[model samples]
Target: MRLHLRLILTVLLAGFAALVAAGPAAAHVVPSTVLQLDVHEDDITVEMTLPTTDLVTASGIDVPVDGTVPAAAAEQLAAYVEEHFDVTIAAASDATSATGTWNVDVGDVATAEVEQWGTGAFDAVTATATLTPPAGADLRSFTLDYDAILHQVVTADVFVLLRSDSSTGEVEQTRSLGAITLDTVTGTVSPLTVDLAGGSARQGFTGMLLLGISHIAEGTDHQLFLLTLLLPAPLLAASLAGDRAGRSRHWREVAPTRRAVRRITTTTIAFTIGHSLTLALGALGLPVPQQPVEAAIAVSILIAAAHAVRPLFPGREPLIAALFGLVHGMAFSTTLSEMELSGTQLVLSLLGFNLGIELMQLVVVLLVLPPLIVLARTPAYRPLRTTAAVVTAVAAVGWLLDRVGVPTPLSTAADSLGSVSPWIAATLWIAAALVLLGTRGRRSGIRRVVSA
Candidate 1:
């Protein structure tokens, strides 16, 4: 009896130790299968990111020697997933009542790695499972009966992410409806009936607005180009404004506050108009060559940077801004036109998106302009301008090379520069304050010396 009791205790202790060790091993275990659902007007795009081992186990496919899934295995996997996955879409009025056989087609299958989870460390396969309902069927409100991985591995969970549902206001941002995991006791997988509520047009418009704001914020080259052009605004163009007496040209002392403000405002407005027109036209069936537009934007930055170092365009900053703004507009157009928007949706999205871009541009201008205006009067302004122009030129050259097919770290660093924007803003404010204080102290000292 004592020996039996000791054996039982030994077993329990071993199990307890194993459970304790599993706490760290949790990461190694597959978390859950993710199905990214992107909803469009006519159809729904389902992106499945499934673990390789789990897929092989679930589909019962033979692994090839090269560790890559063979054609036969891939087809088998797709067939198994399709058998377990389905979506039932109905008309807006009969969404709850209408129930008939719906056709769900699994599109091209592609193997993908979960790069973020771990690369060369973990394996995942991605496939596009599209469901195109009948012409009049509503995409916004539908029932999704997806039982992909959970069908086989009862404990396995499936995360359903609303990637880009125009009707539900899920664009670049994602909102989780819930997970599709089995009830361990009941051993049942339930349907994820997604009845996304709200106006598609409104959702699309707002989504595009937020996207535009994010796009402008991330496109460092665009902001850099604009800021560099504005660098020389406060300086007098002197002989470089038109014709010199054939003597060496130079930027004169800072211009009046009103003149500087006027120049900045004009430049900002020209850029807005330039980009807005192209953004609208591009969405309204304008064919924009993406590659050339990207390259041109980089070139625009380089040109602006050079202009700052030496008065290339002089007082014609707004003209240059407008011309390059056309290129930037084309770049911006790519963001909207890719959605394949049309009619009222297209028009509203275009308006809302441009409004967002303008709003952000204005905010950035307001944040950076005051410092530039304050510093222009200082003797250090010329050197400051030269340094900023040089840095911008370097970043532009990096981006130009990258867009033209040559990759470098400078572009990456420049792109990441946005992460430190808060620090930059803080530094600028502190510098402006110090400049004001120094100037006041100098004036007081001069008065005292004169009185003595």
Candidate 2:
């Protein structure tokens, strides 16, 4: 009993530590702003409205029209913007023009304006320009160089809220402008190249595989659901009522391990299928209502956790897993949906990301299964199983509450749990090794007793 208690304590402590480390790494949703770009024969037009708060956060310069701006400060601010934001037109036959820069005089580059509006919630600043392409210039591909918040304030980080195709209403591909440097005195912008081009099939596959694996690694809700499913596996034999002959059956001996593995594999695959479908659909210009989908996923995790303890649909765990997985998949699709890939790229990414998710799920299951199978054979398995189920149920309830609108510490704790996987793996490996040695010692002791 003491050994079991200690084991449970160790597991719980490790889980808690992981949660603390992972909490802040989760992606955060923020308010949206619009960026519209139009391309023409001679030059390209760019228009955008950025949130003031986000701008301030990203660029550290609080540009206030009403407030005082010393000549030096105004010049400093202008220099910062010039260095950070850039617009370029890439034409056929290797011709290019810097449309975003302050002084790119394409013939009759008229009607250029930057405007700021609002003092409160819907506040935004806009920049718009019309350019006349130089004679005999090609206008097929126009590359916009922009890092809205990186220039004026050196410490600010910029994130894209929204981007759209003016003609089709399809979301445009946007890439993160990775760490950028600005000259403090000159305010000249030096943009780092982080290629945004959709890669080849093989590259996409590798990327998708990594993305899927990382998603499972980082996703706390999915991890908790898996843990809850395994909690009851060790006590299945004790939970069943059977005669001595039935107890000695091969199926009975292996049922826990089989069932645990089946559940894990089924749930993981179901989740993969569910999300893959949605990811492909969403990425292919399908209109998915985002908020409801996310909320449904949270609810699904709650249901799966509840079912883990009380058998919500006994003998049909896989079916339940599949049904709930559909919701979870929609949740997973949100990540890929944001990537804004073109048709071929989107398909390739979906395959890669799903593969990645499956790989990670397999790794985690392998890591946890040995201890689980060994522990199940012990007399203390029942109590340990019940305790784990109860704890998981509680955390699920907390996540449900938070996802439904009321945030709590439980959800926060559950969300933070992924950070400890390495430590958990190390501890479990050590425990499994020790348990094997103990099992051998016990068998030798029993043999000596019988012989004596």
Clashing residue pair totals per candidate (backbone < 3 A): 0, 15
Q: Cα RMSD (Å) per model?
A: 13.9, 10.0
**Per-prediction TM-score:** 0.79, 0.64
What tens digits encode model 1's per-residue C-alpha lDDT throughout 70-184? Answer: 7877788778888988777634537455455456777566665564343333567777888776555666667777777676777677888887765533566777878877878
Worst 10 residues of 2 by lDDT: 104-113
Top model number, TM-score: 1
Candidate 1 root-mean-square deviation in Å: 13.9
Q: Write the per-residue lDDT of candidate 2 for residues 341-363, one digit (tens) a residue.
A: 55666666677777777777777
Cα TM-score of candidate 1? 0.79
